[model samples]
Target: MAFTGRDKTWLRGPRAVGLLAAGAAVVLGLATGGTVTQAAPAKPKPTHTQIQLLSINDFHGNLAPNPATSSSGNVNGTPAGGAEYLATQLEMLRASAKAQGQETATVAAGDLIGASPLLSAAFHDEPTIEAMNEMGLDATSVGNHEFDEGWHELLRMQKGGCLNDGDGQNNQNSCPDPKNEFKGADFEYLSANVFYENTKKTLFRPYTVKKFKDGQKVAFIGMTLENTPNIVTKSGIAGLTFTDEVATANALVPELRKQGIESIVVLLHEGGFPSDPKAYNSCPGISGPVTEIAKNLDPAIDAVLTGHTHAAYNCSINDPANKPRLVTSASSFGKIVTEVRLSIDNATHDVDRLNTLANNKIVTQDVPKDPALTKLITKYQTLVAPIESKVIGHITTPTVVRTNDDSLESPLGNLIADAQLADTSAVTNGKTPVVAFMNPGGIRGDLASNGGAVTFGQAFTVQPFNNYLVSMDMTGTQIKALLEQQFSGLNGPEAPKFKVLQVAGITYTWNPAAAAGSKVVPGSIKIAGQPLVDSTTYRIVTNNFLSDGGDGFPAFTTATDKFFGGLDIDGFANYLTAHDPYTPVATDRISIGS
Candidate 1:
């Protein structure tokens, strides 16, 4: 097989040495046979190359550490995460691997940015890209959030430049450092499945081949979830097409093999949720889209690193040939790093799957922080302090969290929905929204109060997408269809697992045992304490994301009289201000029964 591409090079030293050694052994055997008997030369040990893959996923620009007591700060009760700690962990792991005579490559699955805190998002995630470059990231796939600003911005992230709006865009500064222009990513942003519709070309390189000093090579294929368009803002990905993950990967196997690269790994932005959520190092009853993708992958692919479910699990799933293949995920927000070791047979250049081992390591804070990362954080903090510290409002509770109850409704989600409803209802001479819905995914963090006062930074962190609020008229029938969608085809076969939308000014009952499209109990939906009339038109509000049928809510797209309002975060801020010292609302809006 011929080696091609930029990294390709002839691997002749090892084979030539082996041939010379074999000839010498044959000559000695002939001489010994003609003379006195001599002990047969000991058989040579099989040659192998060791490689260490350090991986993280769904980092989401966590430049600062989550409070030690916060859920995002720890992994199974151990304090972890923060760009400083993550950088230190990666450096230490690489050093350890080097001591063991192994070559190391650092990689990520996706979601390195977007839906980020003010520190990173304020400057269009340039800080996050710089931090990732400093941490020695080799490559990463593009997550759905990466297209939040559109594919053009994603390209800018790869090939550096300031946004055309420049500084003070979106009320936040960009490329704040006058001396340093935004230099893009040092690592490759691989997008094997995403392509340009006009030219039929991949948005980024499909795969990248890395060569080691010992003449060994490994190919990494990266891709995001195929359902990206349905989840991301439709306008952002207007000219792109996301292909099927399984077919995209399997199709590349032959091409990679043609290049004589037998050792292959895939970095996928989709992942699975384990039944044992606390089992960060083990997969107990793991099931999701990733499970099926892994099972159907070409047997030639040695391992898979996944993300997007924000789960941490180390599992060995069966490949197409029914052979176990390593699959891992390092939970979101830089909380964990996965260490994978692969031993490749030098002669065949194929991975010894039986010897492959993987483990998920917490990015613990016990070690000293990486100074470079700390400096970078300090710079951004200094620049963002004024806006971040401004008081947004006060909350009666210590924290209004996004954690959902039995019916998947959260206090924070309810508050956000009410905010959107109130904002749209305040409009004069227009259709006033009677109710609102908020997707659980949009609530990124808790509303933590310091002495009952919440800061703009906290509010921004909680609702970072900056999605516009949209008010529309939906008939009672359409509303019911929207509710039924929660239990139907949002994710995959097991879609009933809490894709529920948080609601305000409405209450309804659902039957978990009922069929998917009929999960919502008939005649149970009520608006403003009145039974829903199938023909009555009700004004509803949601972020622009859902108005365009995002998150599998096609009912929102069919609504009439659509009106776009201000940013959702601004409405949330205004609501917080108007209802100072707000109390938590009961999550009894949605109920589950027979």
Candidate 2:
């Protein structure tokens, strides 16, 4: 459940690490000793010193000041997610660890790349790679978007060390050769589960053994969702196969043991819990697959660091009633960093205890930007300024994108589906530019088209996740079956959250009382103003998220000839810019006639 971009500022920041200790400082009775001296209370017993695991997730290439809504009603103004603020935060956390006689590590779960704005995506993740290096990310998992440019491009980005100027400090790696250019990453990407099916080769080192100042070794295993094939373009992962996550972790545990490392932590690329903007303590209890995965995962592994849902949580999940296996996720877009402090048992070589601490600090502009990295960002920013600032088009009216809103369809959703159908049909070299479908979950935000002009950010508010346009061939019957899956609620009782689908090239009315496949109201199905041929195979364009079965659309999973390239947002923007000053007609793409 990638968080759709929005201005939900009312939700309070999730519970941060220090808040809990502040309240419990006295209530837990740490100040009182067994024998309290009458004069000025005797000093309390010392607490166990702990190592800090610092982490941030979904830092989507925000190298400059950006607008984000705070959990409070504050608009948060233009003040979040520059690498400089992150650096300041990390530095402060490190200083605290130094005072505590413990070690601190900075890390991220995933979304290190892809869906980035023009600044980073212009060079295909180079800017992000540079920023992450400056922020000192120790290790990261292979996020689904990491495969956006394909695996080969990722390899180049990872190996192509930091960019360098003539200072001789060599802040970045200079590409050795044009063809063999390699820019090495400050950290490694761990994908312990992704493997090549034909060659049986593991994609990357499954886990990294990071050492602390005190020589304590902790193994970090990184695994993205096993459903990567469904979310990413087929061409990007043609031969590679994604195995089951739990199965992969179970197999890797023994390997870590062989390496004399048993204090294992999983930096998994998955997240859960819908955060309430109003309450800091009321984190949406873990209800997604991630919580289940955390519970069923090999308990030998100590902590699970997760991302992708873009929500926030700070409590223990799935160990016992009160004692919990620590699981936490910082909200997306540099909103927060989760700090997990683990106390390792020296003799047993295991994580003796775990505590989750969250920091909901805004990545503000108050911090001075890193000179070297800022200069680098300025260089790229200059390069991309023209295209990024270009005025694409105008919207007739504001389009909303609340999943909880059960309207007929969203204006943004219609625009995106229209582009998918049009662009994919032109590329297929086909005569009948037939059907297009856009998953509702992919339309992230609403565009306020009135009283103001639309910019890149305004347009991106509608479609931001960077999903690629995927075209597949499916029989009319199969398409109907796919629609049935959306209505069945097989995903969950709230499966309705995933039920919205925008369609083009056809119109039909649905009835809740009718049988699943036959729910289409008779005489209501229309294709090109005629009747849909049930046996005819139709060419359909949709996002890769659904083509591979994201959001439980199994019907497209079996469809063939999946074509992918430009992102869904980009395609929509291209469509808008090309056909601007647009009308706001509903277009009657799909109708639910009672």
Lowest lDDT block of 10, candidate 2: 19-28
Off by over 4 Å in 1: 1-46, 164-166, 169-171, 424-429, 491-493, 591-594
Q: Candidate 1 at 303: error in angstroms? A: 1.2
Candidate 1: minimum summed lDDT over ten consecutive residues — where?
Answer: 18-27
Estimate TM-scores for all models.
0.89, 0.79
Clash counts for the predictions, in order: 0, 17
Q: Which has the greatest TM-score?
A: 1
Compose the digit string of candidate 1's lDDT tens values, residues 254-365. 8778888998888899988888889887777887788788778887888888999998887677667776677888999999999877778888888776656677899999
| Model 1 residue 418 distance off true place after TM-score fit, in angstroms | 1.5
Candidate 1 TM-score versus the reference:
0.89
- lDDT tens digits by residue: candidate 2, 339-395: 556666666566654322333445555666667677777776666655455567876
CA lDDT of every candidate: 0.81, 0.61
lDDT score of residue 122 within candidate 2: 49
After the best TM-score superposition of candidate 2, give how far the Cα of residue 463 lies from its true spot, in angstroms.
4.6
